[model samples]
Each structure stands twice: as C-alpha cells, then as structure tokens.
Target: MGNQRTTTLEARVSLAQDPATTPATLYELCSDPSPEVRAAVAARPEAPAEALRPLTRDRDRTVREAVARNPSSSQANLLRLVGDADRWVRWAVAANPAVDTRIRQQMVKAQDKELRGLLAEMPDLEPDLAAVLIRDVSPEVRERLAAHTEDLDVITALLADRTVRVRKGLAINQRTTAEHRHALAGDSSPDVRAALVRALELDEADLQALVHDRSVEVRRSLATSAVTPQHIRRALESDPDETVAEDARGYQAAGEPRTAHRRPIGKRFPGRRGR
Candidate 1:
C-alpha cells in the first residue's frame, strides 16, 4: 500500500520537506528546479530563512502555501504572503503565530469558516474574539473553542449546545466542571456519556451517574476503564451483560492502586478529542 523508494524528485521532495530534514539537504532541495521540491523546503520551519526567501516569490501556489505555514517565516515574508492571489495562503498567513498582532486581529474576523477554525487555535487569540467564535453558526468552530478555550463559563455553555459535536467537545474538555460533568452524564447520546467515563482523571463522583446509563456501550466503557473506582468496578463485575462483567473483572484487577482516582502518575489519557 505504500512506495518504498525515495528515487523520484517527488519522493525526494517528500523527504526534504519533513521537519526533521538536515539543513544541508534542505538547502540542496531549495535549489531544485522542481517547484514541488522547493515547496517542500518552504514547509520546514527549521529550514533557514535565506532558503525560504526565494520561495516567497515562487509562482506556485503550493510553494507559497508552505512558506505561509512555516512558523519561522519572517513578518516581512508573512506580510508578503498576505497579499498572494490565493485565499488559503492569506488564511495561512493570518494563522501564523509569528505574524504581527495587528494582522492577526484582522484575521480573527475572516468570514471563512476554515480560516476561522485555524485562528481559533492560536494561543494569543483575543478574549473577546474567543467569545464570538463560541457562538458562531459553525458547530466546528464551536468544537474548536471547546477544545482550546480555558474559560470555564464558555465550556459550561457549550455543554448544552444544540449540536452533538459541540457537546462532545465540552464532554471531554478537562476544564468541564464537576457540575457540568454531572449534567452531561445524562446526555441523550451514549457517545457523550461514554466519552466522560473514559477520561483517566475524571471526578470519581461521575461513576455513580454513568454506571446506570441507558447504553450498554456506555456502561461497558465505565466498566472496562481502570480509572473507574473500585466500588463501581465491583458493581460492574456482575453487569447483566457477560462481556461487560468480564471486562470489569479485568479492569478491577488493574485498578488496585487507583484508590484516590486523581490522575494516574505520568499519564495524560484524555477522552475523545475528535469525532
């Protein structure tokens, strides 16, 4: 199902474009006659800016896109890219963290949903703009907000959003309050309840609510997770479904040291962060 050799210019371009590519190889690749090869170099953030300088004026949109996405690209390069004929190039420039703050402020208001989606993940995103995106008509945008924004009130409101996607984002977000997790425990979608139980560091109190969820899948998720409290696991050891009960026994044995139910040491297994 995959090519094994790096013999072609196309194959060479793929290798040179990787972030881990050596600088000397990147320099050689930058001078390749193929714009595709050069585009690959432009995408490497670790590539020298001098190599990237020539690509800013490249005729190919793909090359320009790579330069626009490179975090190490200078403000001048980004400002230059912002005026490119392609909208996605400009979108890429707007999403660049190293770009000027003034430019980024304007980008936050871009009408394009996908562009807005990229802006949603920017670490320096304006607080007011963050609020605006949460209410945006795009559930995808709201989902990103749920994944990124640390604001408690925003996460709380998203829990009750009309769309399941937005609700899912909040359902797994660690910032979700115990109160919110309690409310979400009764969500109509088994997916939502199942997601909450799989979180490695959830409030121990959640087990009480989720153990009685309508979906066997939801109950099985709680039953099988080593993070489930021992008392809850003990109850699940006799679940009506034989497979779920078996899984509970397997989990219960692994859960002996998890008495406190605080996050497991050095483990960061979050609930579903994607659809």
Candidate 2:
C-alpha cells in the first residue's frame, strides 16, 4: 500500500506537469491518499468542479486550503470553505475574486469581527455594504471601513460617529468632502480637531473662524494654514495668544517687509554737489 501511494503521488505530479493532461487523469489523482497529489490536482487549471469539490472536504486542512485557493473551484465549493475550521481557509475565500457579492455580504456580516474587518479592506467591496460596516459594533471594523471606502456620504456620517477613533479616520480620509470637513472642524476632541485642520481644505472664511477658535492649538494651526488669507493675518495679529500673534506677524513680515527710510546719500552730500 505504501509503494502504491508513492507511485500514485509521483504519477499525479507527472500528470500535473503536462499541460495536455485530461481532466479524468487529474480527477483520479485527486483521490490519491497522498495530500501532495491532491494539492497538485487542486492546482490544475483543467481540474473540473466535481474533482475539486471532494477536496473541500479533504481531511487535511492544507489540502482543503489549496482547494480554496484554486480558481478552478466552483463558487459553491469556495462558499463551503468560507466557514472552514481554519481561519486561513476562510481568508482565502475572502480573498477570492470569484466570491460573489452575496457571499461577501454574508462574510462582512460575520460574527467574527476580524473577518468583517478583513472584508472591509477588500478593494472591490460593495460601497453600500462598506457603509454598513461603518456602524459595526467593533471600532476596529469601523476603522477599517473608514480607511477603505471612498463614498463621501458614508465618510461624512462616520465623521460624526461618537467614536473619536472613527472620527479620526474620517478626518484623515482623502475622499472627505467639504461637509465632512466642516463637521470634523467642530469635533470636541483636540486630536480630532487637529487632524481635521491638517487634512481639510477649508476656505478663507472657515480658516479665519478656526484661527479664532478657543483652543490654542487650533488657532496655532490656522496661523500656518496655507489657506490663511491676508485678512486672517490681520485677525491673528490681534489674537490674545502671543504665540498666535507672533506667527501671524511672521507670516505677514515674510510677504511684506517693514520699510525703513534711510537718509539719502545725495541729501547727506548736498554740500559737495556740483563742485
């Protein structure tokens, strides 16, 4: 029996290497006692769904994982592996492009927060489903959603989320819109406020308002905001915080030098003129 299994494994490997090997040849090898032969059959592009289906139930997790990774496996086969005992097998299902939106939605709603978070980061994840993840009970899941989805409304909603960490994600999202920016600008947390100030592209009026914010850090940020207008400079000049005022003065001074009238050389030399 040992020699027969070894011979079968070697024959499967040889058949797998031949592009012209028939599906029947590969299918027979898939049932070989050796997991290595089964893995080889699982990887064959021409291996039929029927042949691959049995491997989904293979006793060896490694062989099952290889079956899950195979593009040749039917969607049904992949879905069956979605709840495999091994997390890596489920991860392979999540990573499969052929996994349909319905399956993805189910996975996104999984009881496992880790799986939900992983689904949130998939590039082709449906936007509406991603939006749902924005409200997931787990902060880590919501954080992943905020980091991945580009939907303006979704991000806008996340910006107002009670969780400061979620709001922080919104503040940093590049797709954040003007409305989102305005909302984050009013966030109570200074860290969230600072993140908004750094990431948002506020207009002059908005920038000027932030410059006068009660928080010294917010005011300090506006003093250096590239969008800070000439009028903002005047506003900061009168700011109560001396640091803010100094920054404003430096900004103004860099753009417009202080003029000092020098005594004209000709005026000083008038007595020597036209000798």
User: Per-residue CA lDDT of candidate 2, range 1-275, in tens?
Assistant: 23545565566577655778777766777778778877887776668887898889999888888887777778889878987888888887777767788778778767877878888777766877877887788998888778677777677677767887888777677777676677778788877776666666775556756876889887776776665566776788768888877666666334667655343476568866643
Per-residue error for 66 in candidate 1, Å, reads 3.6
Q: Count the backbone clashes (under 3 Å) in each candidate.
A: 0, 0
TM-score of each: 0.65, 0.68
**lDDT for each candidate structure:** 0.75, 0.75
Task: Write model 1 residue lDDT over 84-169, tens digit each, in one string.
Answer: 77887888786676876666655566676776777676664677777788788888988888867678777776777888877777
Residue 72 of model 2: what lDDT? 70
Scored against the true structure, residue 78 in model 2 reaches a CA lDDT of 83
